[model samples]
Target: MAESTDPNPAAPVPGLPERILLGAAYYTEYQPYERLEADLDLMAAGGFGVIRVGESVWSTWEPRDGVFDLDWLQPVLDGAHARGIAVVVGTPTYAVPPWLRKTYPETTAHSATGVEIPYGMRQDVDYSHPTFRYLAERVVRKIVGRYADHPAVIGWQVDNEPGHKIFYNPQVFAGFVEHLKDTYGTVDELNRRWGLTYWSHRIADWSELWTPDGNSTPSYDLAWRRYQATLGHDLIRWQTDLVRSLVPADQFVTTCIALGQQGQDITVIGEPLDVAGANLYYATQDGLELPGAQGLEGGLASFFVPWSGPAYLSLQADTARGTRQAPFLVTETNATSIGGTADNFPAYDGQWRQTAWHMVARGARLLNYWHWHTLHYGAETYWGGILGHSLEPGRTYAELSRVANELTAATDALAGLEPVSDVGVLVGAESRWAMECMGPLAGPAHSWMGDPGSYDRILAAFYRGLFDAGLAADIVSPGQLADVGPGLPDDAAAAALVARWRVLVVPGLYIADDATLDLLRRYAEAGGHLVLTPRTGYADADAVVRSTVAPGVLRGAAGVHYLEYTNLVHPVPVTGAGWTGAGTAWADGLLVDDAEVLAGYDHPHLGQFAAVTTRVAGAGRVTTVGTVPDRELAGHLARYLARTSLPVDPWRDARPETVTVTAAVNAAGERLRFVHNWSWEPATYRLPAAVRDVLDDVALAAGELLALGPWDVRVLRETP
Candidate 1:
């Protein structure tokens, strides 16, 4: 529970080795042929340090009720240990066995009241259901109890990527009512806080509450989402606690989060975990190019890809680091092409090494691919792995093998590296859930329909801006803002928080409590630059629109007020002092009070209102962005903020169009720089300081030109 931006960095986890652990999820059970020995030899030869097994096949683990087949994985574990490759045993709870589903039909999750989701897919059961919970616990104990003492087992993956479903079962809804009753103490309090009197939605009794299936009320939807997230949190916490009791303290317990999954708050779910873990998958090939693709066109699907590819990938990495504000494990990433048959865009040549180094530079302690080999027949048959359908090593295997060897060579300098960032981006699950319920922005093709990804788009835009401007950032949640972890005095804690992060960017924070908003205002007043984007502080914690002026409590600090806003059907030209870019999707009609207008609209009708403004508040500054700025505009804003608020970056001289650089401090307090040429064309950058290449053990003087080939990356440590 340490403060995310603590000046004193967290020490490395006790049990982990002092190196970047690299491997893949090995599913020996799924292989068509018995080649366990061959695979283990290949992994050892490839410099793999670990392998994850037994997370997916519940049917294989427990083929029938009250029957367990636990010995099948002994050979895989024994072979892995013999080769010095560590093993992370996973509890097969995410996917239910056919026997359990067939015998307990009522445990099947309901998408709507009385409408059961069929059992063809995984995570189709209501985990909160007592019957399902009992069976899941039984199986978890059976699996962990069997392998906890194995010499090869170094950790436990509690469950594979949870939070896929929001259960609407009778028991789940009933528990929600009980949860509401406990939280509110009475029905009247719920009615008052939720403003249930509007539209005759007030209920005299708890029984009168409507199910979430068709609840159009924003408050109800937010509460439902929050409660559902708790169910997932409780399940993970429960599983982790159960696993801890069975396994030794050295065997870490963690659940890999599929970030942005439905009905789960990653920050909350990660609290009980020993170390944060996440599955990061990104578009490869041309999608990995820098200064490349155009910005998202406001489509929900397109939100996954941003104007800057590195920015999008870094965003996910930053998010994973944010969960614990420390080094995290990459539980799963693309070994080859990810997704369906039509999406066979694997990494191009050295793109794999570039990405692996990128993850390491962003504070990843371990990296594991989704799988070892591609399955011959399954729903994800086309989801390629290191080895192809032919089960032969190819380009991906060679590329990853080289990466693993490099990681092994650079282990001493790269291990337990804490990424350095001067900027912090605030992200909250409530705001995201509230935005999803409200759908304030429109889709690219249809302005009439609401875009469910409005919050993601806004958050990504600001983060992309920082990345495009060569500024490293930490993605933080509102909860981490005030948590000045154990043993810090109040005065020192406040100073540590402000001194650690010079600037904070909060975008689309539509749902914020008074404390969170007040903390943000105080941060600005305490000599930190506070950047507020559109839809921030527009509503209360309950998703109710504030009666005060937009931005509510922070309006005084921001020195800006807006009583009206509009959703633009097309992009509108925006002009500032020395920059020109377009605002897309939504715009706020800002009526500035005392703030200096930084930008304005070019359209005739919207020309009277300011597009961006800033003001000095106490010892710091507050900047307000009234619309979603395009990549160019956002980058300009980020550069301005960085120049005024952050120390001059050492790698600022590098060309950002092709070459990008990020820095992290290792446990030994040595700064490590990861430089990548994210382009098809070869590039070179001058060393800002004398450095030694950790991987190659080569030294270079300050101002020496470093040549990099296509899709290349270099890890350097600063030298005197």
Candidate 2:
């Protein structure tokens, strides 16, 4: 596959350093005692280069409405600048102040119609409300105006994680109606498109549309979700535009997006900002282990986002990069532990370094922890930070210090790094929303309710497969593919996409337009491996099921039809040419017509249908996986796909069981490789070619064995 520069250019921030920045979120106001100078000194000593401040404490920024106390943070900025550490000033908007909340009860967001979300927690206000926006603008200007010219300020984070809830406030519902009118043009058109004739739901006027509290209509739910996402986008764009007007040109603006948040889409929300920023918090310790770590079951219950060992981290990083198809900043990650009390699982020795380098390898430009010091009293009191409750540096701090030093040492090689991808996994926010509305998979304990993470579960199965098979993949968006223009008959665009991504793996693309489905077919015909999994092309963009055969428009190219599918209550054993594994959660009884059977169910009844099938369409091939494959089967499929589609590389030869190697190319036209050992047992791999160790500054010859300690990583650069 060919490598290309990032589609998005770097932000024109001249004062910002051209290197990977490392630090933590510093909240001096939250400190129990006066420790601004002490914290700055400690950060400098630990090789910290950037610190994100002032995002979480809105009440502290302004003690009351129209009463600004912006001078308090002057000392923190001055101290950071004196120590040569750059700062990212944050606008305190996500967390509303107590005074504002009490005075403007009308601004409170409703979780459901007429049911207001109780105050106390952050992000409870209806940000789209005029009152909230007016108050927010005042504090934002007060903060940014005071520190816009500070030499230490390199960037501005407009808000903390922006999308926490889907606002059900009355005004928000009114806006939703307007959004629908703008989209569909008329109530008649909406009724026809959404098939509202069912259950006598067709409305004569837009006012008859009911609230989302008890709506069972998929079309309405999908639109509501999309509108909510746009609200998040608008909020970010509004804040960014406001900040841009006040801050100097050298200061970039962004919002820290929680990728798995319900109310927003990262791909759309990051557009108005200069660069994409995300908060990546994963399960540490055994959760970072590979091979032995089973798939999504490891951390799915505790977190909203699906976590499956190293693949989870990779998926999150790839998602961030996909937001802008450029290097993104990790605004908040694990410093010690990542959750509330009873959820303490700090990294084991080298895991922090491993996680840090893995993110960098996937195109992260900055890695800032969630916090500097763990709070003594608050909602997140047990969300551990660099310093513990005792205010002393310990193992987490020391490990992160090592990570900081390594990042500093390899800054030149790591700058402007674009991760090399052999496969593209199509990720659609619309499809995700649709899947959430009418989930395909059963919830935990085989409950009657649908799993909200059904989309992620299917996506992660294939993604984890790629990770386990040691292949680098990109999480691509439908908008990115649509931007390539129509495919297939337009051979130029089709061939361009094929050249860019050798294999395109689409797992849960349940809601796609006709153009996108046709594009995938054309892509396959134009010499690209199109891997289709369950729930793909089943519904249109509006979440309406297609009347045609399942897999919709691509059925001809896929060479198979699935008129019937069942939610698997137990794992169904599957056997292929040489591998043995089982299908879990879902199974589509794929009746093949002209395709070659690659795998079949081992069950006596289900054996009548193929579990997997592939066929040639022009010069390329299309593979259809009828069920959600287990880790083993997914890995087998991934390895087979990689071998068939991607060119052979030396890194793929003699790979160790516990090791993963990801490659990238920097702007300087240098090839960089990240080799990681996820096991407690030490591992070794022979050098593929002559290379220099980026972190160690040592040279090694071809065929030399490179030894890695337990939970270790080695950054290498290929030399001619």
Candidate 3:
């Protein structure tokens, strides 16, 4: 086996390098056979330390059923090992070979409508099919057993992002039925929980149940999502276990959580991996509001705006880190533009550098672009890389080389660095799925007319609020706070976790179980501050509305109850808490009990009820927002809570659109601050304290005004 780059290689099985890793996805089998030596020379010149291969080429490895062609990969591995470059191998099960597919047509994934998906795209096979299992096992065992002893192999990626598709074949349907039987133990219990009596949709027999595709019932839809997530989790865990058994203890096993899209439960699939890895691509074009402009929503739009990139990247990074309680790897990111567009935008000079450093700031241990060289032919042919299609060094390669050199020189400055945040934003797939069933509050699913008012949009706005307030925060998941059972006392752990953050904000948490509710209660009772926006705790884990009251289970903690709510077509005036602004979308007519009114509607009739209320549950406090707060008001509430309810002093003068700041600390007790100018115009920023720039070793006095050009970033090391 290969040794690590560290001097003390016996320290432990490190997940990634202590120092940052810079590399690209290299392919030796694709086309226009690259001169291996020349490419390696260019990579070495760029100061790359690793290359990821063997991910997208299962057919290349096994052209026929039993014929394993392993000789072609050895030269690539040996050459990289000779040049001191580590390799991360992958089990190529994502793309089924043509021979296997033609032989077993039943292995193809079927849609919810019972239409089979053809075999052109990757991951089109039914993962749970018996035929697929037998073939995949043979391929994975052979590849892992063959390369387990390769000196250059340092890591293994289980499969390329395992949660992209949903399968609905006969096997999957039977599995779902079996899963329901196991969960509820009886058809009667399932019928009762799903409220089948509402429309005479009760289940009489196990086979009578249909897939929840066209169903509008929230409970059935939620169960379907849960079942789908279970499948993904099991599949990934199985692959991870197989790889772990084959590889040595020193080599890490992981899979990339691609794009932060929540088709699969991230927390579940990530539980079995050693390190959480993800692929991210942000907008390279200037002034592109992608989520709104490109129809991508719910934290999927990276680089929508200047601050949007950092906000979304931080969200995904925090989600990954929270999954494993450790730093993660950027296994796949854009070398240039991404996607299957005819003409995609390119990363301008300094843009890729900014994106890379921002990801590191948010806690990425390794950074590798998707592919080394742009493809000459494929569906992703237009997706450019560092080397253009001509196999020559281009502008991207030049910029990447500069970034590589700088990272190599200043590696010591970033050693043992970790992000420290004083705020946590709780999110989950259950809530997203629940909202999807209810559809967007803006009426039709396809209409963006009310795009300003959807469940995910509101949550994204809350996250953007924290970003605009210059408060560092982590996007926490409900699974992170879930109970580990067996008398583990999840309440204590949940309290302690929330105690680390000054504020815990739950945005649009529609489906919350009792355990989660109790955890939130324990947090508030133990002197932790929390903020709950609209639609939190309205339904249970089964997606059934609670009969007690609106915001059930959390009403006691919120110190208020509401029975009625309305969707506003236009903005309504709101006044309280030393701020006056208009609220939009929905308004809950709350009945205040022990809670103090923080804000109230300016309407004559609705003004009687509280718009926002703050209550002290025990030693801690909880604030409930009755309506959707706009950007300005959201920032106002964040500042108000941080200043009055928490012990953090948020950064001053960091504007939402123009200037942004993120800070972290190293093991040596030194603080590293990233101050960015996201605007396209020159701006001046006054230093918060006297500090030295780690990049250039320049010292500046406290309150010294520094002028920054467009898209400029300064890495400052706080000096006492």
Candidate 4:
């Protein structure tokens, strides 16, 4: 557990951004004060705030551990503070001082396979080690104590993403075993639940247990799912707790969770920290090529919906595979990744403008561009940065600045507005972890599924249905209900879909959290009309709770007694609501009590819950689609959204697949629609009349057809 402390006072709350809050990180190590000062001039003019001051200058900061240096950095940070800008100082744990590593060789860890490694991976350190913790705490206290009150210090970034190269630390074994015990209480219980006796992996005592070695089952195999997420999360949590003591409560302490797949368990990782910040790089040449966790839509939904608090785009890298080979950084906004680089220039000013607004609308509290200036490699090679090697104010700089100025002016309106959504998507980090583990590439589970597209197919199809229907949504993770202002006031009644999203598109969720389960029980009992699929409230986060038996928890609220059976198929010629075609679907059968089956198997042998509905919880309706919905079921989804009074006027005229949409409702019950088109070609369209496209100043009249160019977006606003 971390000791409670107050963080540094951040910069003035410059109101809610009408557009996205634009910022750029300044890498001061590569340049002198003069260059930084010159760059600061452009930064201020471009309306940039919040510079991520890094601790990478170990050689510059300390000649030795105790001897700290701030001579070079003082002026830049102080100057920025004087100019009313915020500085998010980074604690440099990524690059350990060579002396420290050489002196304490143990700092370099031994892998699970038992190999003594040297200084080859960057940002690699075992979090389970007490010695490393001591050093990290000492260094953090020193830096944070010194600068906690500094006017410029608004946030403290605790170590870059934890992975040094495949977060394969020896700590995994210790941490995982410990987490399993803490969660399951007894080794015998763990053994029984995991069905380990069958595999000859049964445990006689907790001490005998350990994370499986180099070659073993994936950590997510339903039996070990909770233990796996908890294990990965525990390591991250331990490090964050150490940081909490040094930083203040006001000065948010956060770490970036990059490298999605095996390296970091983001959901569990942030449990010990304050800010759930993410480093999102859309369509970039970045590495870490994991299938289940990559792609633009997946990345956005994964990060945005899960963290139930204010968010910051921590480190968005800017780069291009062009002749000049430059990347944009230091600041966000402006045109696309095109500037001094040849063939990669901004296509149109308006496109970037809309992108900025769309991100803000989605839910970015602060957006930091990757690098402010391209660092001079001291004659090695030039890389990613907003400004090129010449240090000229590239075309993007001016354009970005212009957008910043625009956002600054509009912050007043933006701050007053809140998001509105009716479509509900359940995000389960543990389930995602399970899915990843189940995949063939790495980790656990043995499945012959040719590709690992099952997860994406289901999630993306739902996203598209919402878009075509023009219903924005407040996507929720299992434990995120408390995030939407407490007490669920009347004004916010429409937006009050916590456990299950209010009433619209309550997706048949998998692997639920206790909080989510309890919330849904309360919501359903309160008169919410809900549709339940086969697996509603089936498995807990651990992928445990196999069969929902009588007197067993979660069976009552879900209103279904799910029987354990596998290999169920979707009913063909499925014609329920608007779905009437051959579509493949995963099925789960349950004995219905209070719920009515809307669509299901008409055959004798195949008894699956295709679709069902029940009116429960505050005039809310629940519809659970039995299996992963196929793309052809979009019309059925649309019909459900319409029947439930979900706002379907936003992009209703547009093709169901052209774009994706999610909606939200503010305190005033005003519907705010977020439309995203992730295609190569541009799209053009007239947004629905109920809402206004404040971005391009377009009004969508009902029944009016408009063609949204490729990759275009429109925020349709309406009233509930």
lDDT of 2 by residue, 305-353 (tens): 4574888889999999889877788998888877768678878999889
- Over the stretch 1-720, how does candidate 4's per-residue lDDT look in tens digits? 111011111132222223345777677677644676677777887787667776565545655766777566778888887776778787776667776677666666655445655664455555446776676666667677777778788776777655434333556555656666677898777776666666687779877665444324433254344444453455456656665666666666666555343544443465555545555443221111111121223222223222110111111211010001111112233223322223232324333444555555554556676667665663212334567667787765766676677667655445434343344455445555455444212112436631243443445555544443444444445554444436765334334543234353434355665666666555545444444443445556565554547213545554555554334244344545545433344555545656555555555544454344343444444455555444445446655656554333434545444455544333344556666554545655544545556445566665565555544555566532
Ranking by TM-score: 2, 1, 3, 4
lDDT of model 3 at residue 189? 96
Candidate 3: stretches off by over 4 Å = 1-15, 259-263, 287-309, 443-453, 482-495, 602-609, 648-657
TM-score of each: 0.97, 0.97, 0.91, 0.72
- Which sections of candidate 1 miss by over 4 Å? 1-8, 297-308, 445-449, 485-494
Clashing pairs in 2: none
In candidate 3, position 450 carries an lDDT of 40
Q: How many pairs collide in each candidate, listed in order?
A: 0, 0, 0, 66
**Of candidates 3 and 1, the better by lDDT:** 1
2 or 3, which is superior by lDDT?
2
State each model's CA lDDT, in order: 0.85, 0.87, 0.75, 0.50
What TM-score quantifies how close candidate 2 is to the native fold? 0.97
Candidate 1 lDDT score at position 270: 90
> What would the C-alpha RMSD of candidate 1 be, to one decimal place?
2.3
lDDT, model 3:
0.75
RMSD of 2: 1.7
For all predictions, the C-alpha RMSD in Å is 2.3, 1.7, 4.8, 8.8
Candidate 1 residues 1-720, lDDT tens each? 111234656565635677788999999998998999999999999998899999989899899998889999999999999999999888888888788878999889899999999878888888888888899888889998888899898899888778888889999999999999998999999999999999999999999999988787888999999999999998899999999998888888888899988878977789888888898888788788888666853121123343337777899999998888777899999898777776677788998999999998888888999889998997989888888888888898888999999888887897557887868899999999988877788875554327878899898888888888888888889888776434565445555567767888998999999878887888788787899999998888889889998878888999989989999888898987876788888899999989999899999978888898999998889999998988888888988887778877668646658888888887687888889999999988988899999988899999899999999998899987
**189: Cα error in model 1, Å:** 1.8
